[model samples]
Target: FSAGNNENSIEAHIGINGEANLDFLNIPLTIPEMTLPYTTLTTPQVKDFSLWEKTGLKDFLKTTKQSFDLSVKAQYKKNKDEHIIPIPFYAKDFQVLSTPNDIFIPAMGNITYDFSFKSVLITLNTNVGLYNQSDIVAYFLTSSSSVTDALQYKLEGTSSLTRKRGLKLATALSLSNKFMEGNHDSTFSLTKKNMEASVTTSAEVQIPILRMKFKQELNGNTKSKPTVSSSIELMYDLNSTATGTINHKLNLESLTSYFYIESSTKGDIKGSVLSLEYSGTIDSEASTYLNSKSTRSSVKLQGASKVD
Candidate 1:
């Protein structure tokens, strides 16, 4: 993500200056160094990924806006006695001579086209841009039953700002309305230089789901990755209809590995887990012998019944 504002490399600086800047809400944004994730995305960075993850629909659609990205996806399923197949070729921003959506294998089968657009955004970081800016984003989905109608639509919006409000805070407020599920979600995040706190509230019915996270980092030696950290998270899930909390700790060493552990302070299945991940340099001989990179990584995870 923009290389975390490094200053030592001449090439990095040259790369940054040789970029074409775009605008999102007139924020002097740029195309991502990588491919754009989708077309409808707005940049900087709201931490709304978890909200989408909880909805279990994040992985269904993917899009890219650069460098001729393409994907062929197929799904298999069983229905009654007939087997059906649907293959879709996704291409970005290309004016097609013919519609790719209609080129199915078994003509006029049960398979139908589902045309959807992915939400993607890329941005540039400026001292006086993007911060404190708010916007409302809406999506329109077409009906499969009829091409002219709408099956469902969803709207999500966010406003974020970072300032030295006595303690250097980056605050973000986000809200989402998913009419397809009759759900309205609100999330708030406040992060200092070394600490972050977030709360999310969503309701599908009378009992609203609430989640919270609070974290603090010690010895801030990195920008994107923290060296030492501690956190507590509380969650109430609609499925379990119960509440749970976890306390977590992390210790990371650059260019090598990291260790982490967590304990559930409360949950339907109260438990804890400890894990360690190590990467880089497993032996020069192994790297040469295996014809692989000079790096190797390993992970271990174990569960514990208690927190105290």
Candidate 2:
């Protein structure tokens, strides 16, 4: 019989000049083996035994399996408009082994702009990045084997700007693009805002195997203890293929309202209450994908009363 185990870890960092970093790692191990009882018999007698004769049970033996894991990541950035230039860098690496004999490595890197356009209400930012993989090796108790190495190169760029229209009205726009070995992806978003309400929308499209996506969000609240808030999101994707096209869509909506109770020195009591809720999601898949959609929902209701 075989058994499996899983482990996970997360890390975070923050530095001076508005630099932040985050990382996550995971590992899984599995081992399988079999055992059999010894029989009382001579070499000729063993051959005569029907139990051993029916199948190749004598060839079975217990075995042990082992695996290894390693992950490394780091990010640093500093931005100051006073200085003409800004500096930023990010890097990540992941490795895995099914058995002590096999090894794999995946890596990514990024470097971006510094802080010189701070004075402008509307500012632009950009970055260049790359992702690649190294060759893998497999080892056996007696010998070793290696696989042909492969690498992927990527270049990315982005820009965003915000402008104030009037006393309480403002708008912002963002655009980004990523170029891979033989594929390209691009995204754009726009937002309009005012004192009482705001509206925002975004869209993304990828080439070489066409795909598209869109999303929107809205929010508002009042000072009352039992304040109410709600939000909704929608996403869609279209896949082009030789056989046919596959389309997928996801929608999510949620609302929450809650209040608190307080007591005074004279033993007086007060109470506030409201209803809360949430909902949304996409279908599950056999394995994790770089781009996938999922939805979540939640709700709550509670109240308390006091007497003096």
For residues 201-248, what per-residue lDDT tens digits would candidate 1 score against the true structure?
Answer: 333322334333333223333345544333333333333433344343
> Any residue pairs clashing in model 1, and if so which?
38-120, 41-120
Worst 10 residues of 1 by lDDT: 281-290
Model 2: residues with Cα > 4 Å off, grouped in runs? 1-169, 174-199, 223-232, 238-308
Position 188, candidate 2: lDDT: 24
Measured by TM-score, how close is model 1 to the native structure? 0.20
What CA root-mean-square deviation does each model show from the true structure?
A: 28.8, 27.7
Cα-based lDDT for every prediction:
0.30, 0.28
Please report the candidate that would top lDDT against the real structure.
Answer: 1
